[model samples]
Target: MDIDRKKSTYLTLGILFMILLSLIRWGGETLQYLFYLRVPLISGALLFMLPIICIYLLPSMLGNLFVLKNKWRMSLVIPGAVATGLGIVIIGGIIGTNAAARFNVSPCPLLEALLQDDALTPYLFALILAFPTAWAAYWSSGPASKEMSNTDRKIGVAIGSILSLLLMGAIYWARTGETVSWVSDMLLMIISILPSEARAGLVKDDQLTPGLVTASAFLAVSTILYLIGLLLYRPKIKKDRWQLPALSYVLGLLLIFSFLFGLLTFVLDYYRVPVLLSFLAVSALAYKLWKVDHYYDIRPTPTEPPKPDDFIGALKERLAHQQGRRTLVVVCASGGGIQAAGWTSMVLTGLQKRLGKDFTQAIGLISSVSGGSVGTLHFLDRFGNEGAPEDSELNAIFNASTEDSLGATGWGLVYPDLWRFSGLPFLHTQPRDRGAAIETDWKSFMKSPNATLRDWVDPIKQGKLPVPVFNATIVEDGRHYLISPMTFATEPLEGLEFNRLYPQHDMDASTAALLSATFPYVTPITRNSEEDDSQSKVTPVFHVADGGFFDNFGIVSAVDWLNEQVLPKRVELEIERVLLVEIRAFPDEEPLQTASRKNVGFLMSLFGPLLTVLAARNSTQAQRNEDIVNDLKTKWTAKDIDIFDFKISFPKNIPFFEIPTQTGYENIDQYTTALKDEKKAYTPPLSWTLTKKQKDAIRNAWEILNQDQSSSVAELEKVWSRK
Candidate 1:
């Protein structure tokens, strides 16, 4: 109780200290300008405004610093602010220089003199006072800000002071040795303070133009609407009270004003300005409303934690429900999913070999969008809900090949090759209506055991179209030739010279023979591979040859086969598992020029820059580093597999920091009693966790180690070893 009170007192002191630091800096800046520097009162007043600007920019500056810690946005805000400031200063300097040139006198003679001063005594003193003052302001404010580094905070304060002084000196010099024209002084002051207004030219032709009247009317109306919008924008139970509708109302008014102006311009034969502004107003408003609409379409939030149970217990509970069934595989075309499935199949088949054919039944595949093709698909399909499968009967899921052009093309080639390589007969079961064709009925075309191999193979073997066949054939020569064998559902290529363009030149004899045999029975299955095809054309050539195939269509059939045939036949053992793999690739290099060696090198250089950009974007240096540390930490605690941190551990022996152990504390009751009685020091108690056994052990150890029933080193050690 005493310790917690002390902690609370310290926290209060820390906050007070922070507030004191700001006050001290402000007082010093004010006093130093007035007494020590002996600057004119007017100059001091303007210099004081610098501190307010510094304060106003403080929050954004800190927020910018926080973003800096993030690698993706690091160094952005500081560099952008510095660039903007430098650009403004440069432009100001140039304008001053040009003005002085026009007057036949140096506008910033004092600045030049100061820069050339060998001792720089005055500027040194100015810098000294400014730097520390700025540093003090920033130090107090920085931790609360984004993108702020300690060095930057100090530099920012110092830079702001120096620039402020320089700008003030320039203004002072420009105003010297004059009647101090009141109108000019006021105008110049307004121009300097409200710099954005300088860009607003009302009467460029030195006349009261209709455009000027229109612009004035527009600004007046906008100002009124803006004030109304602000008043309308209030927190409310109804969603309609939001700013979007208020903004829409204001914009609608603006649009009406613009249309009126545009119509007037057309009536007066002055069309350009009104027409452009009207179009811009409508277009900008439409775009903003669309953006607001997009923000409302959000994915569902994640679910709560799963029940406490062992794996088998959880599985049994889930399966007992049997709400629905689905198949899971790592991927359709990849080695990992296939390998895992193969091992399971081997085990199941071994068990079933003894039981004979019908022992296993009801197996099916659950087709998934390939991870490589589109990572967001699973997240989107499930609306990003990641939890234990709600449906019980789901048996398996397979992550398949992301379909690319090469994969699709490769699938086409595989159909023809499969007939020659494998003996699986092709089955064509197209519905009478092509538009309404359903993939589920495909099994109806499967060859009966009594059907002759020759009869089953004839359709594809003869290259006959619109016929159910086991193989596809094309005669290229007078001698009967089978260019590429294909299946019953094969879509023949028109005007494609078989075995000519992109010919099967790279296929090994074994692969070719294997493909030829099985190709006759293999048919193309479409899956959601849209994203893969787009990426394939640009890079290391994402293709079928690269083992990327999308099999959404095949998945339905595979799952059906699993649920109906494989499960009943005991041909495969299945366990639900998640397929995890990282799919990333660098962008394509530019095609080399064949004109000359130098040309080819130049082309490579051109693409080299682009490749570097691509590599940088794909690299997750910050995320990867943090993830690696977290991964190790997770592994240390044996929680790496969970990926989510659902639990935290606290040592049993560690003394609660809230308890007091002061040596002179004779009246424990006085301090603790005061805490609960007089000062109202108690807050809601924090929750903790401990098993009954651990708690009992802790109590026993505490009693055994501490003879006086007080905390001791030995007692603490015993408690520490509980875990």
Candidate 2:
């Protein structure tokens, strides 16, 4: 009765394909009419830069579609891809050219539409870059021009380099204001011209003229990326195959899709649960009718748990090895993109720095979700031997994680990952997924013991480290799914322990870290499988999303561990006080008068129930954790076992202009009150990429914690010094 795991990819991609084409056509023509219809100078520049898009972006990334020897694959792949792209372009042109275009937006009166006569416009835009596009098309079509025309290459470089740089300079000149929002909106306005990018609104999308000219700047970026990939792609394919080459492509594609989807998401909005389920159901019926038993097992297998393992018992033995009773620490890291990463990294390092050698000895567990797990991985890698991270390591993670992930992931979503609909599953022999993209920077930054989740177990059992629980949410049930060497307690929080369920499939540190942090539509849903205990041959696979859905704070597992593992054995293990370190990424939400925040929008009224439930779950989880802490305090008060809950929050971000570049400002307040303008609305966005300023802001922001809200840092330090 279950949809085959492999078939789920098709269902997801099917939804993407259906909505994507229609959305693009409708969005491109709908005319936000906010800007005047102008035949901009830069549209010609984008045409000149066709070498990158036509040759590299399409061919290099997806040219595998035109596989030389594989006739069957070529027959299906090439035509299908072209048909999809071409049909959508035609539909959009027709829609734009004909019919009184619907306007959900009502800011301005209708101006003369550009595509009212798109029949001539398509040829006009194409003719401008005919040579390069033709050259690229010919080379990419088959074995016709394998080496590529050197003259065309030289011409593309010259046109792309000269014009693209000019476009950038023009953008700099065009920025009327000094705010980050201005340039971003300008770029958004520019990108809105792309047929695929309709339905704006990531942040202020009533673009004016000259925004279209910036498309060249965007194309130039892709051109530069293509050239870089062309240079580096060949050498690495031998070792890593598609993984490395696809990374750069993903990066470039990430930039493109971030803007494309950023705009299109306003309408398409990667949230297609109902549509997705419908597709899945229809596909399941078809498969059943055809009597198909799908055995598509190409997804990466989970790593095996260590042999002769008693994780809990091993931990107790190591804790008992310590000379006397000491306060056992539990760290519950919340799931909030890179914000959580920044907060967790700085706070954990600060804890390690404060506790000195006693940090690992005192802390019993580090239970984290999504971005918190990413930060946890880095902390162990950077400070594992050094005791504390250098200021550079703290900031380095922020910069490294920012850009490499977001666009690269979207690239995966847009082009290659979409092929799941065509049933050419073997085409992507290696994974080009958001999870893989997210793993890239973190993997490079980590190694050895901290490199994988499995790597942490021995150190933890040997009395050297705290256990790391990377919390994920089971997609099917929205329960907590802890990805660690040892199984976790998932009772009150309702989590599925991966180690117990799928013991054969161990996790790498990166997947475990991001398993639960996956944002809807942006990050891929991770599918894992296991043999059914009751049935000898039935192996059911489970799809899991980010852990934030169940418990963003990650307190349930930590509390469960304390109640079941530590508190139960407190007397036997000679345990002292329980110091619960809750690292919170967000500032506390101001207490609300009602169960849910009021939103009066029509869309909100229609789609708000599920979202409201999710929101309530989050707020209620926070309250539940507090209640549990209080209950534990009352129940265990007389046991000579004290409970110290130390909660830490990230300091406010300085404005974009206020964030220091290279000049070393150790802390936020150190920047001085005069320089501090308006506070940033959110922590460094929960996206894949980060800017240097954002990273620096996160690091400098780390210094403002005073620990007076709950148990004082001074008292916590006293507890750390207890042994």
Candidate 3:
């Protein structure tokens, strides 16, 4: 066959294969829903094998059959016989079912009905259709005398098109009943899953007339077939490829317009007028500021005072001595869901295990957000209490706290009766206060009571653990707020006051941790009294949510602190490279794209512009982060600042661990034993601890750090010789 003909044939077969696979999957799901079939092994194996055979193997085999001259006759005969047999079985099953129903006769249960009662009809029909298409191609490829005439070829194409249309009609009829419109059915499915508020304007009633069903079904089938025909008979590929660019531009515009419309609708629907007007006002003000080239001058907080007794001064003096030389290892944790906490803990534990006690000592700063804060604070507490623990001890601590810290209870919300009835509540909550239950539980587990900021200050003063800084975002102001122990540790401690320089007030460790990790919607927003009463005398409280709202991973903050604060102070013997270890929890999949035709996919596409904006913003932020790092790298080539970004995704379908509770003092020993057993089993396999992607990241970072260290030593030796 010629290249053009071969290409056309492959394209046709590929489309057919995709359609068949979708039908097969839909059929299997429908069957499972209609009749609770438990053929897990059989269904899984068939679902896996069908795509390989139909899409890949069969296409290659058919291509070879068409190309081979002499072997074409035999190839046609084999497929023809298989097709004939499948057709017979399908027809026989239909006939037998009709006859049995007409005669009021039932088939024997033991003997069974024709090949599982036509369950394989869809597959058989797909195979049978392929045989005739292959035969037509072969006939067309034959010698001049044997080749089909123009009229015959036209008729053949018409017949194939008609058959495809009919098949689609039949599938639609089977999927949606005579009294239900397919579009309405789909909308109903979406409505069932959507929240109560979103159900407005959607078809609430599923009732539809037979005529409407038939018309809608026909329209739906015709639309699908038209699209398929367009794909098959698409305009020929031109050398200039002028159409490609135009097509892309049009699609891009459509996507942008759709996204904007969706976003505007959502803003109007959710926040109503005042918030939207406020946002618009802000945008106008920002635009005016930008026009004057003074937008960047609007600082969120006042500049830091040049006090030698401040935290930065303390850090500078501590690192002034050569013996006290340290690398300010700033660990930025990424926010995902509950899995983020687990992954963060695992990453930190792994780092400590591989790099040893010195690694812990070198880490002078730790900044985290949401789930990352949970893991960071947990590790700091453990390290302070137990020093640099062995691998086993670290693993045990992680396992024990992983469930309570990352589970639903960690959100400080009470679950419904069903959740408790299913014994999931124990894993998530403690018997104490319902709100901030996770914080209470964590405090109890650590055997530490909630202490004022002064308690934490003594440690940093004595050079015990690193200065822990957690981040949260204020919703109303739309600014990133940094919470640290030092920020709250005032000399003349009086009434709580929000400092203009620090922009954060002193709170207990539990509240600080909870505020830092308070994910929006999941955990309720925290309301705290502010010292400044200028705004309003009635309510002078600030609302704080998850730090992820402003900076999800703490990457930008880490770099900013390193350059603007640490480097300028000339900390360490000579400021060495600022190493950033970011642990991400999300998978390495393409963002914002969803499969077509799915309800969720449809919703996502409708709101595509919002996602696009978010994606663009993230990309820009990442570029800015890289620019900052690159700037440091250029200026401090000797120190060699480096970044190691690692992501560890949670394994699919892993069940949450269950925790045991005590009934009374008599069963305390049993509960304790069960808890130990649970902890032991809670630890997943080593393979699950770190994915290959994460391992590679860790290895690369280790190599970079070692290389820089070696280079620094060589430079020092040369300087010493000169001296």
> Per-prediction count of colliding residue pairs?
64, 15, 0
Q: Which model is ahead, 1 or 3, in terms of lDDT?
A: 3
Candidate 3: residue 341 lDDT (0-100): 59
Estimate candidate 1's alpha-carbon lDDT, on a 0 to 1 scale: 0.26
lDDT of 1 by residue, 206-263 (tens): 3221222222332343345444533443222231222221112212332333333323
**Residue 468 lDDT, candidate 3, scale 0-100:** 67
Better of 2 and 3 by lDDT: 2
Give the poorly placed runs of model 3, Cα more than 4 Å off: 1-309, 312-326, 385-393, 405-435, 488-505, 529-540, 571-573, 587-606, 638-723
Best by lDDT: 2
Worst 10 residues of 2 by lDDT: 34-43
Q: Residue-wise lDDT of candidate 2 within 1-723, one digit each (tens)? A: 247955996889999997767755775643333121111112233334544552345432332211122222122222222222222222233222222322334322222243332223432332333344333333333322222243543443455345434533433343333443454556666556645423322212353232232332333443454454444332211212232322223223323433333223222322332433454576566546653321211222455565323545655755654577656778888877766776787677666556564564556778888778777776666544322345456455443333234434543454445444323333442335445554553565553423555666666666556677888787777677777766554453565676666555555666677676776666777675334567555455778788887778778888777776667777776777788888887766667676533464576879889888877887788888889888877777776778878777665444322222322224634644554335535434545444344455555555445344343455667756756
What is the TM-score (0 to 1) of candidate 1? 0.19
Using all chains and alpha carbons, the TM-scores for the candidates as numbered come to 0.19, 0.59, 0.43
